[model samples]
Target: MARRATVYQVAERAGVSIATVSYTFRQPQRVRPETRELVLQAARALGYVPSGNARGLAKGRSQVLGLYAFDMFLPCDLSAPEVGLDDLVAQELDRLGDVRRFPLYVDEIQRGFELEARRLGRSVMLGSGTSRDSLGSIDLAGSVDGLAIFPGGAARDLLEHVGRGVPVVIFSSPPMHDPLHHITVANESAVRELVDHLVEQHGHRSLAFLGELAAPDIGARFTGFQGALAAHGLPVPEEPFDSTVLTEDSLRTLRAAIASGDVPDALVCATDQLALTVVDLLARHGLRVPEDVAVTGFDGIIAGRLSDPTLTTVRQPFVSMGRLAVRILTDTARGLAHPTSYVLPTRLVIGRSCGCS
Candidate 1:
């Protein structure tokens, strides 16, 4: 077997130092164009392929970005009793086949990360850390140049651990006092606008928020919900329909609420996924949407568009957020100034579900 060509051989053939050959591959901007061309030609003639490990060692960078989400790939809980499917709902779900296969929000963000990373000459490494054990187990310190984290699944201790060694950008979560950077949506403002639409346009006085108030993002939405109601001189509901995810438990709770004759004029869900489940559950109980009750959701996911009464939602700029995350991480890697926190804007999407034309 023939021995593989080395950087030394390429340097000798190109009449350049070994350091120049390394610089040509790792930091071409530092090498002159003519010298770079000469090194490339020699490498091509020698059939030399640069080893990623060797390049990383030389440049002290992996040229890769790591994306960590806790529930990005968690499968939907399909344990609810089978109700007769609505034609529009079925079609919408079918069209969003990828959402069904993976977590919608995470998948959309990943798509954005991939596109921007490619343009920046970097690759993405995706992983899920749904629990403390899993979050603490990943070895990300030396594997990538920078990291983007969802931060919902991991604890502060775990985040501090990984972030101590690399630059990290958090997504969909609030900024902490720690040195880690953040890229989050305008959750409170978006929810405030959504609630204002419900009250001012539709006169939905009796409204209820459905979400786990303990969660950071959900808590922010809840704050917006309360603020909007307060602005309208309406009292906050005694209790919020609490559920972290749209599961059978959430369905059962909603059923109980309906049975007790406590159904509100409008149901404000924290996420589009939750809203989709609520709409389906309401249909099963023979409640007409936007007629008997109005419904609104955040995160303008694809399924929301295809519902029988299309969901009224705040369309989060997931793709743009992903791109921004990459840009911040890359900037940090390059010793450039980047914002410690960013709150991107969201737009209200009027659909029939919110009783809008």
Candidate 2:
């Protein structure tokens, strides 16, 4: 093989000090973009190769990020079965080990991360958000220069403290405090779109919404559902069924309401799981889905596809959300100024359940 080029040669070709060259490749988050570009150009021209040993010695640190994601692993564990648990856990662990691993999940986002990491010559270490008590001792203490946190966990306070020490980006909705970055979907608008599709296209006027109404995101969804009804000039029915759970008691209550001849023409669930449960309950009551009462749900989960009369839903760009979180965190790591909240786009996925086009 040809003689390997040295960092000294690369620095000389780039017309920058050895420190700048090292920061450009090793600790890129600490260097300016223009300087990084110059160093990369010099390396390419001089046929210089990056040596891990040289990079570590120059930067005084490893080029890796501390990433935390509770979203994927949480839902997967809840939805997937015990038999497949081992495989799912392995896949999750693999996600953490992958060098380009931060919080990025979508395809385009992954591509962007790969490009940035290559240009910066850095790697990432993925970690799950701690279960509150173990938050501090969970290796986020100074192992990495940056952090990416998913929503719906007790580590918020811990992350807040970590944010003070390093750049932190939270991938969640309902915007957090300033200086901390967040990436989330347009939850309300997407729910409105689904509700409108049901009412206008599918002829559903009387409707009921089921799910945890206490959640901020879910509350927004309910507002959207009600707003759609008002916009359509549809009267809000008296005592629309509000269900906390899809257990036998709640399902029986719905069945009784239907039997009493005051059933909602449509039922919009807060999640795919709730939607599936409602569908099963309605069937048990001799109500044919869509033919008797239409249904739609939020969160385009895989289970929705398999449910009878495949569920119509609002697709909450989970993958994109993951990727956006990664981008924001990396940006913060590099000392770039970004907003506290970034609302991404969401879309409606029509299915047989909605009885619409």
What Cα-based lDDT does every candidate model obtain?
0.83, 0.68
Q: For every model shown, what is its TM-score relative to the native structure?
A: 0.81, 0.65
lDDT of 1 by residue, 171-207 (tens): 8878778888988888998999999899889988888
lDDT of 2 by residue, 1-357 (tens): 888888898889888898888777767998888888989999998888787545544565546665565533324335555658788778778676442223223333334444555556667666654355446424663666666655444455666676777677665456766666766677778877887787678776678877766445777777777777778897653333665654445655566787897788888888776787788778877888889889888777666766668889877677566556556666766667778888878879988998854
Residue 128, candidate 1: alpha-carbon lDDT: 63
Q: After superposition, how far is residue 140 of candidate 2 from its true place, in Å?
A: 3.0
Whole-model lDDT, candidate 2?
A: 0.68
Model 2 residue runs over 4 Å out of place are 1-62, 69-124, 129-138, 153-156, 235-262
TM-score (C-alpha, index-matched) for candidate 1 = 0.81
lDDT of 1 at 284: 84
